[model samples]
Target: MHILFLHSNYPAQFGEIAANLVAQHGDRCTFVNERVSGDQQGVKCVTYRPASGATKQTHFCAATFENQIWRSHAAAESVAQLFRSNGALAHDRPDLIVAHSGFVSALFLKEVLPEVPVVGYFEYFYHRYNSDFDFRSDLPPQSELSAMRLQARNAMLLLDLHHCEAGYCPTDFQREQIPAEYQPKLQTIFDGINTDFWKRDASLSESHATQRMVAGVTIQPYEKVVTYVSRGFESMRGSDQFLKVADQVCKKRSDVRVIVVGEDRIAYGGDARFTDGKTFRQWVIDNNDLDLSRIHFVGRVSREELIRVFSVSDAHLYWTVPFVLSWSMLNAMSCSCPVIASNTAPVQEMVRNGQNGLLVDFFDIERWVECVLQTLESPPETQRMGSNARQTIEQNYCLTSCLDKMRSLYQNVRMR
Candidate 1:
């Protein structure tokens, strides 16, 4: 079978699956992307320029509106042109065309190859009303929810279905968010983790490391670190709640340190001003009166450094409401860092309270603090629970298992 993998950023969700597929069926898989960060071994990758242009506007005035509209349209056209010219195939065509599109890229692909079956990974569908608006305090208030969502949904890049084959989501919660009519076109498959790499057995010694640090945070094995990894300390990520609980947790344990991974604001919108001046991390620390000495706001730590932190930390802390589980949480769990997460749908799927790890209510700030404290206080139980987490990941959520499921799904989709 000839497979064409499409993602705006190559190997984003397909990292493990892509490798496994290419290894199993060499020369049968080809990938095309605008943003290929690093090369992948077997998959033929064609590089294309990312088409994005906009005039500088002091504010998002009407003058900037036309420029952005033109840019988005031009980006779609550029992608279409690349697909037709560079990507060559035989009578086999593509048995499956998989894309992780959400930024108008997929729309562009449809414009070019309307007959090809394009599958999208639906990451998010926003209902920009009620909590949704406040859910993103970092973002300036949108003038109109429906109008803005129509624009933002275009950013989802999932609109290819009108001309493409199907769609996929990493979580059921995510899939359900799509319009009920669209849900029929969606399939839920988790992008699993590689247990071998993420396992608790990663050497605590820094000599094995390639001298890389996560977001520049060094990993010293002996420190009593409690880590939180996210794109940022934003509302959706429960950053405010984490701060509240952290402040309370620190009141009792002075030795424990909190380290959060991922970008602050510069990585998100390129400017912190978009995220309300201080960013969520800064806002939390300032308003909560957190001691920076105990709380280290490590922005955009590298994956290697993150592993190092997990290798040595007392516990891994992740809290989210109704969203898919963060890849960092799985890595933390695979590393045998006992996870303490909110008892939301996605988290409940991973953490089986007092089994592999612990779960707390999303809004219950006190329980969040208690679980973290209790996990650290009980060393033996903590280690045992951590072991359980690793074992669970190895058996079910491992990369190999996920690949098997992915291949089967592709075959099934093609056969249909």
Candidate 2:
């Protein structure tokens, strides 16, 4: 089948799925993207770079926002114009259209080729808004600014949802957010990790040997490293809470270390340099007078580096409010890295709490600290949980299984 895939960023969640299909079925896949990032496992990818510039979140200006969302439509129109200019699409329309709803491409693709079956990657649907904005009742009266920002963002999905033939959500939690009326077309697919690259069998001592040596000493295996991975240290991620609890944990125990991996900008409510507030990163840096030396931040690293981080850690630290859990958690599981995630929908499903990994109260700093401390106190139990974590991924979320689901779903959608 000649499949046309649309995503704002090529080879993201949709890119992996698209690449998987081409490798397994020899399907010719054309990917229209906002930016050209990189090549993939195995796929024929054709990119459509919009003549317009990248989307910017400037001071509230109606004209600027419209230009950003509609850029993809303008670009897809160019795709149709290019086809008409060459009589290409007219000769052979795509068998199916896979789109990502968070982007503008799906709506424009619908306009360009009225007959193509359009399936979308339904990343999110935010009708209720970011409650985290109001979550802090203690810090004076609340402002609706964040909620307003989220509501304004919700308007972007309306066109994409109405035009889709089907929607694929990476997690059941994400799927649940869509309205019941739209749920008929929703399908759940596990966003997975490449187990081959992630799965490592080195002993604890061996794994500890390669860990980042700060001031030239193997981060001792005796130290219980609770690691958190993400794109930043931000509010939604509860990075601040993680760090705050790390402070609490540090005072209570000497053998514990808090390691944060991933960039901190746009993480702890934007980077410290630009954003006025002391983001969790800056907070950690400021509070180094305490046992804060144990609180460590590992700068952003590549995928292979992340696997190594996951492999050596005793626990995968996670603190999310409404944000989606990072792929790092799945990679951690593949590496048999036990996770201590917030009890949110997707996380609740992933972690069986004391089974594969532990789940803590999202906002309860004391409880979160206790859970982290528990893992350190009980090394044997933690190791057993880590083993089970890997087993769970092997059974349900391995790369091969995800590919199988993708190809099967594509066939089913195409057959219709």
Question: For each predicted model, how many residue pairs clash, with residues at least 3 apart or on different chains?
Answer: 8, 4
Candidate 1: C-alpha lDDT: 0.66
Tens digits of per-residue lDDT for model 1, 170-276: 77777777778778877777898887787653445223334424334554433456778887666666777887877777778876667767776533222243445
| Candidate 1 residue spans exceeding 4 A from truth | 37-39, 50-89, 129-158, 202-223, 266-276
Q: What is the C-alpha lDDT profile of model 2 across 191-221, one tens digit per residue?
A: 6677888885475425554444531224774
lDDT of 2 at 170: 85
RMSD of each: 4.8, 3.5
TM-score of each: 0.81, 0.87
Give the TM-score comparing model 2 with the true structure, all chains together: 0.87
Candidate number with greatest lDDT: 2
Q: Predict model 2's lDDT versus the native.
A: 0.70
Error of 1 at 403 (Å): 1.3
- Local accuracy by lDDT, each model: 0.66, 0.70
